[model samples]
Target: MVDNRYTITVGTEQFRFTRDQLESDPGNYFATYFFGEFTEASQGARELVIEKDIQLFRLIQAHLRGYDIFPLPDAAVPPYMTKEVAIKNLRHDAQFYCLGKLEGTIKDLEQTSVKKEVKNGGKSPLARRYKAGECVISSYLQTWTFQEINNDGYQLMLDKLKNIDIAIPSRRPQVPGFSVTFCWVKENYYYALLVSDD
Candidate 1:
């Protein structure tokens, strides 16, 4: 029961989208393939078979539909979908499809979700929720796992920080110490890092 359209078969699933829709964002992989050309005359053109993950393909469609894959915070997730699962899926999809524009959207959504968590009361269950670029005062330090500085060289310490659960910030987290790189300073307190050693 499929209406005629640009049918892309991915795994066992098939999706249909108009040429206009597929060409909407020429910057995207699929759009680029069909744009500025006689797509109808392209070799073996009737159907495109995708060998990658189908879950991610859905994310691409969602983005084309609304610029972002997420529904409103209060909206019910569609059948077979949830916000967390969708975000995770779309990230892989964006990478596979070379949909680079979606990277910023994903980061923005993650930051926004965490901020909402903080504002609603504070302290999400996992310290891993702390994103790369965020800073916090000593009062909320419990949400993060701070590491102790040892005699190890700065590069070694920096490497260790990478293994920590700190969510990679949009710009990457820096120890930024004199020897330690550095992060932020407040009052008389100074800390080069905000992630737990756990």
Candidate 2:
């Protein structure tokens, strides 16, 4: 028997599916067609990304259609936090987000310093943990210019300081919009470029 347990949230609506439902005709067709199109697409260097997104989309759809794709709770889940609330919480909780020009400068420099310590066997345990290549997420608020400066300087500084593993190197799009760019400073402290077209 195919296990098709999964959860899906569309806007404010949440739905769950069992394995049997996921394996049902409609669910399978949706999964197959969507993934088939994704796989057949001419992806140059972005094949992996395309595949990953397709898989995620399929899983979500499967869950929505009552497939047991994942072992989820039967209880009603809480509503998702609003985007503004989520962003606000992230800023409050993240260790690396800076508020002003001086804060941005100091944060980046401090992270760079930590990177140096990890390389030379310094005292920060967090730095050592980071040098080993772990996934981290942080949020911050800063002026657009500071964000740009951080983005420009990020890769060069990482190469100079750590000589350690870096995952998913920073990418800057040609499009105009607001987005955050993440980079390793030293070990624990990170430099984030918060851009806005406003």
Candidate 3:
């Protein structure tokens, strides 16, 4: 009987996976390459060779083998890379491999990370980009619009706010510290009008 084990050569590193494992996720890069019309046998190939980052590939393999791929424990992250870098790298490889599950997991990690960062007083992308003297408008905005986010207040905002985006606004230099010009609650939701004097 022919061996069903498949050898995957990624760069100079070599890893082995069973045929069933490689074909588990149909339509993914591996399944498409191995079982699609361009079968390895057609080219007399002994093993699958992928010219990609081996570190990312290793993480992908771990994920495929039922490992929780996101929010990796401290022990799992190498000394050379931070947890954030690992997540980003995995996100990149997951997209390239067309792994939907991994992609979804990464998104969840991102949201969780954002929440954690905010809870720990880390500045958000919105906070970093927003400037004094500029108006931020949202039709579906909330009362938390320009309210100062005390540690306790952030929990309330994070729980109630599903999404936020900046609509049309006047020009202002990007600066920290702003105030809410107007705020109101509408149908269990909140809206805000923010303006500041720089």
Candidate 4:
């Protein structure tokens, strides 16, 4: 806890830490860039003011302090909420800051989150775990095609499946994140076993 300190204000939120605290992490993007010769001002009031989401930055702070952001469960995470989205966003920020170690941790957490969500019916590209050789059945997903996630229209995937000559099974609305899904036809039915390109 050095006496020399500063505050990094991101949007409406402010975080205070010492130069020593940041330096202890060494390779963190904020630590490397701020204490180095390339630091720039995000705002001009004698503080590092950045225009970014405050909620996610708090998690970044947690990572810098050698801790995982807590009080947030991994299950039932959504894109709109911080707890569910923190690590992913933090990873993005980490990449920007060139925080290599933190990014590795975030990547690991992402893989774990994806695995846990698989049993709980979560559909994220990061969490859609599968391989090319494995034969997936309808238990994983129904045999249907989706297109343009933001504006999900049945395009090529649906069109290709339509031409295969089988019961054109009714499809539920596709989730809004993934762009492409890998599928296979087996046992006279189509199954969306693989999701999103690897």
Candidate 5:
């Protein structure tokens, strides 16, 4: 007989979460994946295999368990990864899971993280602009500008728009409303622009 349990495997890790625990949040992806009509046949099976990052999934699980995903203790994060990267990955996982609340928390953490980076002297030029409530956008061929939450968001966007170069002033601009532009020299031309508020 099939046991009354739900199992999820991400990478080399496996996690067990109850139906209620997964469904506690309305519109949660896990809830529907395990209980929705598509899952009727597997309701008895109650097992899911996700080809995603295990460490990131663990953080998502921690959030489900009511642990703060930000400012993660040194011991909680893997030795090779930085908390900033973890927070960034967590945002993606949260989005994939359709965990609205988790996404909200991630945004709050992003803002806080940017502030902390500035204080700790680990911030990029674009970071300060983001902290100032200014919007930044990246683009290729000068057609459309892609806007993200900043800091980690900027990095993620850049990764997606690979073969690009980022250029920001090393010294803080003394003037207000200064903008930074990131361009790249690839086989095909590409560019990303970040405009700050006045």
Candidate 6:
């Protein structure tokens, strides 16, 4: 079943709607239109402040794009009080696994990390290699593998890289901080990794 129950807040007013209600009369346009206007108006703001605040816009867009927002079962009110805030939180949540991959590499599967098992496992040698700072290129002929991971979030990024028709090369940036850039397969977004040495 499609888990609905999304929290939408307009100004100070917040409402939770199930999938049936969202799909029934309101159609999601109300939420989308409001956020669209909000972002459009903010485009002219100073870049520094805008950069910090654009997350609000992203949160709304993610919902309109049909991403599911699951509230943590134990939370009080839901981490997000507004639609924009929810999207930002979802994006952050989606990133957790991807960030875990990078963090796993950074910690080197030391004695005290949760992902030490995945790191040491022989199954994903490529991930292990990439974690160890080795550069590698891989390609996949089938698109199904890519589609299968649509909901896996950014960790699916690696699978998408694998599915590219042309060679997708990945490299660890020489500098410490977490930025690795590879060739462009789609557009301006480069296949990259953010790694930190601990």
Q: Per-prediction count of colliding residue pairs? A: 9, 18, 6, 0, 0, 3
Every model's TM-score: 0.47, 0.16, 0.54, 0.49, 0.54, 0.21
RMSD of each: 13.8, 20.6, 14.0, 12.0, 9.6, 16.7
- Cα misplacement distance, residue 183 of candidate 3 (Å): 42
lDDT for 51 in candidate 4 is 81
Provide the lowest-lDDT 10-residue window in model 2: 44-53
Candidate achieving higher TM-score, 3 or 6: 3
Per-residue lDDT of 69 in model 4: 54
Model 5 weakest lDDT span, ten residues long? 131-140
Kindly list the per-residue Cα lDDT of model 2 for residues 86-152, writing each as its tens digit.
3223333222212233233334655776688778866542211111122233465422223233322
Once model 2 is optimally superposed onto the true structure by TM-score, how far is the C-alpha of residue 135 displaced, in angstroms?
Answer: 69
- The reply for model 6, stretches above 4 Å from the true place, is 1-152, 167-175, 179-183, 187-189
In order, candidate lDDTs are 0.55, 0.36, 0.59, 0.55, 0.62, 0.35
Which runs in model 5 stand beyond 4 Å of their true positions? 1-3, 40-43, 115-125, 128-198
Per-residue lDDT of 138 in model 4: 53
Candidate 4: minimum summed lDDT over ten consecutive residues — where?
A: 147-156
Local lDDT at 133 for model 2:
22
For residue 149, give model 1's deviation from the true position in Å: 26
**Model 2 ranges with Cα > 4 A deviation:** 1-4, 26-29, 33-198
Model 4 lDDT per residue over 48-132, tens place:
7778767667666766677765444544233344343455566688788777777777778777777877877766643343322
Q: Quote model 1's TM-score.
A: 0.47
Per-residue accuracy of model 3 over 108-127 as CA lDDT, tens digit each:
97888789878988765434
